[model samples]
Target chain A: MRRSLFPRLGLLLGLLFLWLPVLLLAGYAFSDARIPFQWGGFSWRWFVALAGNERLLAAAWLSLRVAASAATLAVVLGGCIGWVLARQGPFRGRPLFGALAGAPLVLPDVVTGLSLLLFFVLLEGATGWPAERGATTILLAHATIGGAYAAVLVQARLATLERELEEAARDLGAGPATTFATITLPLLAPSLVAGWLLAFTLSLDDVVVASFVSGPAGTTLPMVVFSMLRLGLTPEINALAVVILLLALTSAGGALLLLRGVLGRR
Target chain B: MSRPLLSLRGLSRRFGETVALDRLDLDVPPGEFLALLGGSGSGKSTLLRVIAGFEAPDAGQVLFEGRDLAGVPPHARPLNMMFQSYALFPHLTVAGNVAYGLRREGVARAERHRRVAEALAMVGLEEFGRRLPHRLSGGQRQRVALARVLVKRPRLLLLDEPLGALDAGLRERTGFELRALQRETGAAFIMVTHDQSEALALADRVAVLEQGRLVQLGPPRAVYERPATRFVASFLGGANVLEGRPDGAGGLDCPLLGGTLRPAETLPEGCTACALRPERIALRSGASGPNTASGTIEEVAFRGDDSLLLVRMPGGAVLRVGHAEEDGAPPPRGSTVQLSWEAAAVVPLLG
Candidate 1:
């Protein structure tokens, strides 16, 4: 209309510059004020002192048990390694299994959290098993980097499915575990619930792979809001970053309403 | 007796250096609907994916009723394919894709909701089982892929190009609702099409195939009036050849313009073709016909209740007649017309 209202007002001022710092940490999480930038008014007082903050509820129960065990082991090992890299084909170490399953998306998350904390300290000095690096080695190092972004978004949604609908579900009798639990798990339920809520929002927003395979009981919830924003921005760290941004916006609005009811019924 | 539900015997495959099924043999008797046909790289959907065991036939035997099927995979093949992309299951709904092969044949949940409500009321989609194959309609996802292979009553079904993506008016009412759902689910269906009028309107026997062998297996009117070669007489239709040598008494007297024809007894001794069927040629003028002659009209066409023409004969070949008179002798182009027929209506053919 008038150059579409100035590019929709510069995309609503670039989405209010990424939601005005999560709307000022959800308005100072009912600010009563531990002297947060002035407006010492409305009081939930850091949501009632973050309900008796016993070490910030033990780092929000070690980030909800390592983001629900690294989003249920990254949705069952990134859905059987994204359905065997979408029905195996490229053969012979398919480019070294697609660069070691997309090298945790181009390395450097502190070099994949210091080489998975030096391969869990050389597998606990060779086979002593996990033997502590905490929260089961930060849920096996955030299920190997959030199962490589849930196996690259469930291998780009199993490359638009149809391996002849699993050979028409193995020609309609369905073996191989009932053709993968009744037709490839209900046709990969919206990319397995958006790759398990993007691997539980990347293991509840990892603090650089829990600052290298954390210890002393794997301090999670983004390493206690990165040590309460290095002891500064504390309105009880904006009420635990507005309750982990309303639990990652109610799991990304229930994974966008289960991916709009599975892409509106396929 | 029931053993011929699907046999195969010498099936073969290849793929690497192209040969998608060579020594292929077949049988499918049980309820027998069997169509196969050919054309695009034949091996008719690779012999319906090696009789629905989702393929794997390097050398022979598939057997089924007689049992072999070797590693018998495709979900322990009792058989059920239907796929020319009616692979339905887009996250199930038409009664969960017709109770997904009746709950993989374990059946029960009230006999899988009474055989997925009697196979969605035998494809007339009984309220289309709570809709979903993208809210149905490619002929209701081809009758919900024929109510998911007629709710798993599979003794063998296969299909492949079952009415290839419909619409030629729902492939003429899904070729009689797939020959009345293979005669009300009698079973042994077999399919795979390259559409020769959908294998002559739903075969009772039609095998054909080409680059992958089985040159001609019979019945749809003996592969359309005896075609065993010259690529099954031009892939099943327009015939009209003529060729030379051999004399009368139904031997090889191929001279058809001024009579004296009859050549099909496997025309050999210095052989040539014959096949005529363009409404058994009959355009006469100064006809004291033995087989009459003359040629000139070179091309006409018309086609609506028939017209065709083409002519050019008097030894310079070109036949193609077909008439039904939309103004009969409007034969102008180079005109000179006269063509006739009836030395036992020609037909011989080989070249």
Candidate 2:
């Protein structure tokens, strides 16, 4: 019998080739030595030092705040748009609307970040509503990117929803709004959760957009990592990176598992 | 006059260039189980949708209890549609689906639960209320859809091919059940279907539609016995059409039928197409009678209940004769036989 195990081996090699550096960084975070590459006895000295690292924690906290705001805004606004696109027929300029919603997905993150920064500067010069760029500005920039992802996820879930089920609810005497709240929303919950988590994760990991828009108040986790890299690579920074990496992985894995469970059920 | 529960006076809908419903007028008495029967694109479904308010007609008014149904959305129509797909909400349990209507009507929570239980019991799904739609069988899903519709207690009910998704055996059983439930509820039930047997079995009266126009409307017996046009006669059942005129030669001789087999019914005004149902004819050989015609059996099919004999007449015309299987096997293929039907059995449909 031909097992064809070569593909699996190749996939493993490819994954190792990509994440080996990340694993080495995590490994070195525990090493007590001048050169991280040299074998040194494992210790929690860096992890302990990371606890006293106020600047890194502040950056991480800012990332969390921006991610939370961005995710909440993205999910709410994207959900509405996704719902409309799913239920309503394609009206005039629907293609253009769809393109605008999905444009950030294909565009480079740097381009998206720079363009959003430019747009914000223009708006401030004209309207002067957000007079200064800061956390709010960073969140707005991240949300623009995060919103595209949320909209795409919600749209996929909505498209897979059976049309007859909603019609059934309507026939049962539900008004349009009631049907949406009672039937549509409950069924769309899992997707909403997944989309929110994904948007939050993306916003938390974002560096380019945060760098472009951040003024005084905001210094996201990635920005902190990049800034610290400009200085020397401290074991404290290594510990922080490992922690953030673990958090991101956990959130993503949880969302994926939840989505699979939902899709697997009848 | 018990006011018609639903009335459509000259209802018409046009989708750009295509006429879906063309000036169709119908009045459904309260609790009458009427079947709108037609082939695909025959406007039967369009008529049902119009009545349900899923579609608004370009012209004509929908009157439910004499109130105009204009600007009324499907959700507020006081009518429910049993979709061909059954359309049970997959996320909700059977109880939830049933209670959906009650909840929307602002019924008390306890009252909604009680009614949902009652509806489920009505469909014999009381114990299965906690199950989701996809978890149930097709027939069970259909029952859940029925329960959901009945829970709202609409004055008029619309069904679009309600049993279209069921297997043959299940469909037969469900059809009888649905008719019984309709009678028990005493609501005006309108159904659209392309299956002629279903229409005959379920409808108190059947309306045959063709090309966006109703060709015939009457009780099952009346429509079957006395078709108003050729299309109705052909669609309702398999029939042998013989074109002839009553020349009254010697003793009324007809040219097309080869011999003067006594005129059945007053032959229509001109050359008439005589419709004789397959089951009405008797097959024989050698001897001739008042309604006898000689033919050779072209094919013999053994259908479980009956045997069908396809006979080729002298002039290349073919006629099918259905005889009980217990009555003995059909005349073997290639055998010559004389086909005969009673004069009254021959239905004169069109000229």
Candidate 3:
């Protein structure tokens, strides 16, 4: 009992350290006070106010749209990149390709955002495409970073997968496309879903990159929350935070359940 | 005779500076179970891959039924492979895996199910159709892989060390099952294995590879009793090799044996070595045979049905002699005995 006491205490302290502020915020969401750190009374007025804030609702919807689009785009492009890196044998540009794929992972988000902003500006100046920055720019930036995460996750999983499975498929009369669709894709489903969820969360919570690329019409939820925090904290923002937290928690839990089901069956 | 079902003409492949396969020619007849036997790095697996269309040769052609297999992808070839790992799809049920090839061939859904069920029944996995691969034992997985390949009804099947993964008892049982399956299906089998016993037991003919070249190819009995070279003699089983110079009289002046040894056939001008199987040497009491060597027994090993006696001669060479246990109690260690072998048991080896 004495030996287990220290570890149990350490775990409790770690959970409290991580969750204390979020719990405090959740408590404020239920309070009727406009100011933080002081409760007026138990009431649901802030939640009603959150529902009436049209701009906040719009920002939340926009964030959802961007996260879904970015996650999907990341999975497609990153799945391809992961396949090439993991399955293909040593080739002429393999080193360079691997380095490029992994570059965004090590590079800071601020640097990535700045570089993407500059690239969009130069691209617009030269091609006259993407006439204005809004949802498109934010999506492009989020996908760029999100794709790197997906690639790294997928490549690691693919590396551990047996190569004989693909060869066996081919020997069993499956063409390359058929093998990819049936064997490779089905086997990689768990990892792909995990990658998609990670990309979704990253896009939803993004502030630095989204700020650099987003225009007037593309104020995502994080941007709105950031601007509201600058103006001073409010119970309405606390309510919005609780809602976002719930969304993230539900998605994470759902992904865990999905992956557990897949892995457990195998 | 009918033309061979598959033929490799001057096939060669190189990986960097190492030659994985030299310019080699081989033929596989219809319904013939051929085993490629060699040690590691002998190019057995490479040759199997080439025939399966997994690896393209650097030169020459792989011909199937007189048509060149060049430019044909592995999937398009009328051949299938049983991987060493059994490579069953973990996500699929046993029935799903068996149906994969039939589905790819555009067989109707009803026919695919029928054929899959039949194949699984053939491998005795009729009740395991719904179970996933991970749920099966090693032997069961192997059977599933075989069912998957057999369902395709390919013209040829390439097995890379098919029984290498199983335990000894399972390997023996599976070996018989594999032979029985091949006979029932009448599909030509080309197996690659480093285990000589497996090759001898399963193959109608064995091809022994050395340094990426075919050193010997013939019936297993001929290859074992009459090895073509020193390497073949040692690789197949234990053979006492006596090195010497040909003595002008159809015999070799072998210092190792401390006398001139006569061979069954006349030695060529510069024959330098002869191999004699340990079992061919007989142990007799007292010195009294046409070709006899007096020696003291050095070691006695009891092998249940037979006893192996190592005899040390005057020249300090230890000759291994195998005799049945019924040959009376083996002369104890350090006891003097005379070893005799017939001239016909002596095989002359070149180089």
Candidate 4:
């Protein structure tokens, strides 16, 4: 009993450490206090104030657009890479190709941001395409980083999938493209959705990468929130944080349910 | 035989260091049921895959209806395979799975539904049309897989260990159903299997392979009663092999049995081995005959209907002799016994 008690307590402590800050912030979001830490009774004033903040609303809209674009791009690019790596047998430089495909997942975000920024500058100097870095540059950067994560998820899912299913499809008179459409894609749908949601969340709040890539026109909601932190905490920001947290939770819960359904059926 | 529906000439495939198939030549007549029988690593599955166009042969030609299938993909081939796992689509309904091939063929919606229902009814799965694959039992899932392939109505069907995943009782029932289905469809089937009894009972002809080469191929009775090679003899029914040479006195000098024996048939030139089925030999005590050997009984195993006796000769070679329990009580272990058989029972092995 004593031995088990220690582990139980450790788990409780770990959960507390992880959830305490978010719980405190959520509680403060309902307060009408001028100071964030001081509770001044529950009110809906800060939520209303947040609705009226045009600059913050504009940044939030920009962030949503960028996240959706980046996540969609990540799913397409990463899914192809994962399929090739999983299905195609041994080929020249496979090891090197696999390592490079997975490189962005482990690379430091600061390094990824700095390198992407440098590449954009060089490209603009060379071809003058993407003449100025803004939403397009930020979306591309996030997609590059998000794609590595999506590829890993897709590869893991493909590994659990039986190769015989594809072979059977082909044997039943479905060509390569048809087999992918009718068998492989339907089987991989859940993983792809999960990958898209994860990439969206990663792009939504990525301050470091976005800071390096974004220009004045590309100021995302996270950048605005980071700047607001220097002026001390306020209830309006707390309300914004709560709204963002709720959206993240909903998508995360969706991903978990989709994955569980896939696993349970198998 | 009528013109072969499919002909494989000098098919060879090597996986780096292992030769999966070597110089295999075979022909499948229309509507013939052929079983490729071998142990693991004997290339039975590889041969099926090559014929299905899933694997490319290192050398040789696959002619389907006299057309060279050199670069044809599996989907373009006029054949289908029932995988060992069944490989049922977990997400699709039974009816949907059966209609998948029809959909690929661009069959009209009404015709596709009619055919799908017909296929399901043939497999006795008409009531399971709307159910998903995971909802069905193992036997039911196997039937659905069968319906999926049969709906295509190809001239040839490849089955890779179709009954491998079933329990023993289910295996027998399913095997009967599968053979009946083949007869009903009248499609030639090339099945790969490792089970000797399954191959012999279901296939009209059995192709026995060893070390990536076809050792023997013939009707089931012929292959079982007259195995051409030592491998086939030893592999099929566990026949005891005796190696010897002609003694120049109208008898075979077998060092293993420590005796000179006269066989019913004249020994062909270069014949050096013969196989004697254990059931063909009879046990006696204090007896002498033209084809007889004396040995001490080593052990007796009591099977349900029959008992097997192991006789150890003075030359140290052990021979197995099977006798019906109803014949009489088995000879006690460690007793001296005379083992004898008819001259015709000794089948000469070519290799």
Tens-digit per-residue lDDT, A1-266, candidate 3: 44768889999999999999999999989997878667999999989998999999999999999999999999888898998899888999999999998888899889998999899989999999678888899998888788888998889989988988998999888999999899888889888998898889899999999999878879998899899888887798888889989988997888789777765654
Ranking by DockQ: 3, 4, 2, 1
In order, candidate lDDTs are 0.76, 0.82, 0.89, 0.90
Q: Model 3 chain A — which ten-residue stretch has the worst lDDT?
A: A257-266
Residues B1-351 of candidate 3: C-alpha lDDT, one tens digit per residue: 889999989999999998989988899999999999999999999998888788899998999999999989999998899999999998888898899999899999999999999999999999999899989999999999999999998779999999999999999999999999999999999999999999999999999998789889999999999888888887887788888888888888777777667887798777798888989988765755336788888899998999998988888788889978788888799998888889989888875
What is candidate 2's lDDT per residue for A42-159, written digit by digit as tens? 9888899889888888888988988999999998978977877776786998888888998988998889888888898999999996788889998888777878888888899999
Task: Give the lDDT of residue B319 in candidate 2.
Answer: 78
- Give each candidate's interface RMSD in Å: 9.3, 2.8, 1.8, 2.9
TM-score of 3: 0.93
- Compared with the true structure, what per-residue lDDT tens digits does model 4 show for residues B43-81? 999998999889999999999989999899999999999
Error of 1 at B261 (Å): 13
Report residue A208 deviation for candidate 3 (angstroms). 1.4
Q: Is candidate 1 or candidate 4 better by TM-score?
A: 4
lDDT of 1 by residue, A1-266 (tens): 44668889999999999999889878867777676655678888677777778888788877887888888887788777776787786678777776797788788889888888999999889999788888888887788777777877777887887778878877777887888777777777777777777777778777887778888866876677677776776677677778777877887888798777865654
Sorting all predicted structures by lDDT, with the top scorer first, yields: 4, 3, 2, 1
Most accurate candidate by lDDT = 4
lDDT of 3: 0.89
